[model samples]
Target chain A: MDEKDGCGQDGQSTPGVNIMASMEGRGPSCLNVDKDALAGHEKPGFKLCSYVDSFSETHAGRIPIVKSGLGKEDLFSTVYVRWGIRRHDYKVVPGLYGIGHPDRASEVLVTANFKLTFDHLRRALPHISAWILVLDTKGINVWCAAGKGTFSTRELVKRIEACSLEKIVDHKRVIVPQLGATGVSAADVKKQSGFRVVYGPIRAKDIPAFLKNNRTADKPMRQVTFTLYERFVLTPVELKNALKPAFIAALVLFVVSGVGPGGFSFSGAWERGLLAVLALVTGIFSGGFVTPVLLPYIPFREFAAKGIIAGSVFAILLMVAISSAINGMAGFGALFLFSMAISSFLAMNFTGTTPFTSPSGVEKEMKRFIPVQVVALAVSSGLWIYSAF
Target chain B: MKNLRYLDNVSTLVLDDEKCVGCSLCTEVCPHAVFEMAQNRALIVDLNACMECGACVTNCPSGAISVSPGVG
Candidate 1:
C-alpha cells in the first residue's frame, strides 16, 4: 500500500509510517531522496530511517529520523551554550524536522536554528507528534534573531520552499513562537507563502498547554515576564564577560599601585593591589550579578541608577572592612568612586540583555549617566595614582 | 505585561491613525501586546510595555506607525 494513504489498525492514516516512508523515498510523492540509503526498521508505533544527499555544500543533507529525547551531545551543547562558549555558532541546520511522528495533519511549529531554541521546542513535546520548521537565524535565539531580522519573513518563506513544506504537510498553517513575531509579519508570510501564521506562547514550556487549548494562547502565555529566576540564569554569561575586563584592570592597578614615593616596593604594592582588586571584583559582582537578580526590587528603572546604589553598598562595606589600610582621604575617595563607576557601567551594559529596557531608554540613560561615569573614573584614577606617589 | 512596565512616557512609538488602514498587522506582530484594535484602527494600549523592537512599524503597510529604532 502507498504509505501516504496507509491507515493504522484504528482506520486512521499512519502518520509515523507515512513520514518515515517519505524520508526513505518510498512515499509516492517523495522528492530529493538520495539513492544511497539505509534499511528502515519498524517499532510498535513508529519507524526509523536515514538517508544521505548533497543538497548544498554547507549542508551534507544527511536526514536522520529525529528521536524524542535528547542525546549526550545535546546535553553537552546546552551546557556550553549556557556558558557562552561558541554560543553564536552552535546551531542545527535549518529545515523541516519531524519531532515525534507528525503527518500532514500534525502541527508545524517554527523556530530559530539556535540549538538551544530547537532543543527546547522538541523537548517540550515529548509525547505529541509534530513538525518543527527551523528557520536560519544564524544560531541566535528567537527574540534576538527576530530583532536582528534573521528570523524574518524572507527567511521563513525561503525555508518553507526549500523544505517543500507545502508538499509534506496537508495543512497551510505554521505556528511561530511569540518572540519571533517581531521579525515575521504574518500578513507578509501569507502573501509570500500561502501559509497562515499562528503565534504560539512566549515560552516553549507552554506549548503543550497552548496546543491543548486548540492552539489558542491565553493572556498569561502571551505575556512576557522576567522574574528573579530568569534574571539569575542570565547572570552567568554576564559575569563571565565581566571577568576579562576585571582581570586586566586589576593587573594594571597592581603595577600602578607599586609605584610609591620611594620607588616600587613589592610587599607594599601587593597589599594595596589586593585591596583594589577586591574592590573591582566586588563592583563587577554588584553590577553584573546583584543588579539583575534584584531588578524588580531596585528603586529605579534606569540600570545605571540601580548599579550606583548597589555599588555604593558594596563600597561602603569594603571601606569599613579595610579602614585601617587607607593612607589618606584621597585613597578612600578614589576607591569609592572607582567602584561606583565600574558597577554603574557594567549595569548599564545589561540593558541590552533585558526585556524591559527599550533602545531609546538605553540611549537616554547612557546620554545622561555615561559622561558622569567617565568623569568619575578619570578623577578616581588620577587620585589613586597621586596617592601612590 | 502586568507588573512589568518599563520607564514611563519614554517610548518613541508613534501611530498615525489618519494613515492607518486598520490592517491590524501591528497587533499581530507585537510580542509585548503593546497595540490593540478598536473600531478597525490600531491604538497603543500600553505604551510603557513597548520595547521598541520596531516590529509593528516594520510590518505596518499603511505607513501609519513609526518608531525611532535606537530609542527603545
Candidate 2:
C-alpha cells in the first residue's frame, strides 16, 4: 500500500483501482503486488496503487499512465530488493506505458520490465512527456538482461510489432539505454522493425539532459564508471549471496574439527570450530565487502589476486590479535590459508558484477588461480585436522 | 575506467575491414570508447580497454565486428 502522497488524487472512491487493474493483466508487471497490496485492502484510509494514476485508451490497448513521482511504497520495496530479497520476482508486465501528456511526436524510451529499473525510469520523467516501451527481460535489469540476450534485437522488434508502436509514435526513433547495446543491435532492429534504435545515456537519471541535447548522448553518458557509492551499493547483495554457502562451510568445519586422536570431542569442536568459523567470516568480509570497496586501490588486475591481498592482510591482523589463543604454528598457517582461499574465490566471483571485466579475461584468471585456490583449501583442511589431533 | 583496468591482452574482439560498410554504430554503442571513425571506416582506438560486451558486433550492420560475448 502506498502512502497518501498524492497517490489518492481525484478523490477516487475505489479502494484499490490500480492494483485491481494490474492483477487482471491490464497494467505492467508487478509479481509481488498481491502479497502486499491485497493485504492492505479492506482497511479504512488504506490506498494500494501500483504507481498507476489511470489507463489511457490508445492505439496500444490501455497504456497505463504511470505516476512520475514514486510513492513511499515504491521506495520501501526498492530498499528491500537491494538486499537480494524477492529480486527475481520483482518485475512488471512488459508493454507500452505513458507518462505525462505524450503526443505522436514524443520520444519513446525503451527499458526492461524489472520493477526497480522501471521505477527509476518513471521517477526520472517528472515534468517530461514520453512513451515507455518495456521489454520482457524476465525481471532482470537492463545491463544484465542485455548481456543475457533477453533485451535483444529480437525482443525489441517483437515488442515494437506486438504493441503497434508505429501507429502510436510518429517518430522513427526509440531510445534504448546505452548498456543495453550489448543485447540490442540497433541496425538489426531498424532493419527488422521500422524504428531506428537510438542509444541513450547509460543511466536513467541522465534522461532529461539526453533529451534536451537532441537525443545524442555525450562521451560521459555513453561510458560506464564505478564510483565509491556505486561499489558500496553492490556489497550488500554480495554479502547476502555469500551467507548460505559460508554457513554450510562453517558447519562442515565444526564437524571436521571434532575428529581427534582419542575420540570426537564436543569441547574441541566448540573451540577449534569457532576458530574456523571466525576465519571463514573474515574471508567473506574481506573479499565480499572490503575488496569491492577498495577495488581500484587493490594492486592487481585479477580480482582473485586482489581478494587474496585483502584476505591475507585481515588474516594476519586477526592472527596477531588472537595469537595467544591459537593452538600452535599449524593452527596459524591453517587459518591464513583457509581465509585466503575463501577470499580469493569470492573475489573471483565479483568479476560478473563489474562493468569492465571481459568474459575472456575472467576465464583466463579463473584457469590460472583456481588450481592455487584448490591446493590452498586442501592444505588448510589437512593442517586444521592435524592440529586438532 | 583508466584506473580500473581488467586483465591485459585477453579480449577476443576482432574487426574485419573487408566486411565493414562503416555505419559507425560501434563507436556510438561501445561503453569503453574502443572504436573511432577514420576516413568513413571504424578503427579500434583502444583494444585493451574493450570489455568485449559485443555492442559493436551485434550493432554492426556489415558483420564487421565479432566477439564471443559472455559476462565475466
Fnat per candidate: 0.58, 0.82
Candidate 2: list runs displaced more than 4 Å: A5-49, B69-72
Q: Give a tens-digit lDDT track for model 1, residues A280-364.
A: 9878988999988887777888899889999999989998999899889889988999998889998999998888778877888
lDDT of 2 by residue, A326-352 (tens): 878889999999999989999999998
Interface Cα root-mean-square deviation for all models: 2.2, 1.8
Count of backbone clashes for each model?
Answer: 6, 3
Expressed as tens digits, the lDDT of each residue in B1-72 for candidate 1 is: 465556778888999999999987677667788888999999999998888887787678877988885634
How far does residue A105 in candidate 2 sit from its true spot (Å)? 1.0
TM-scores, one per candidate:
0.84, 0.89
What's model 1's lDDT at A286? 88
Q: Give the winner by TM-score.
A: 2
**Which residue pairs show backbone clashes in model 1?**
A358-B72, A359-B70, A359-B71, A359-B72, A360-B71, A360-B72
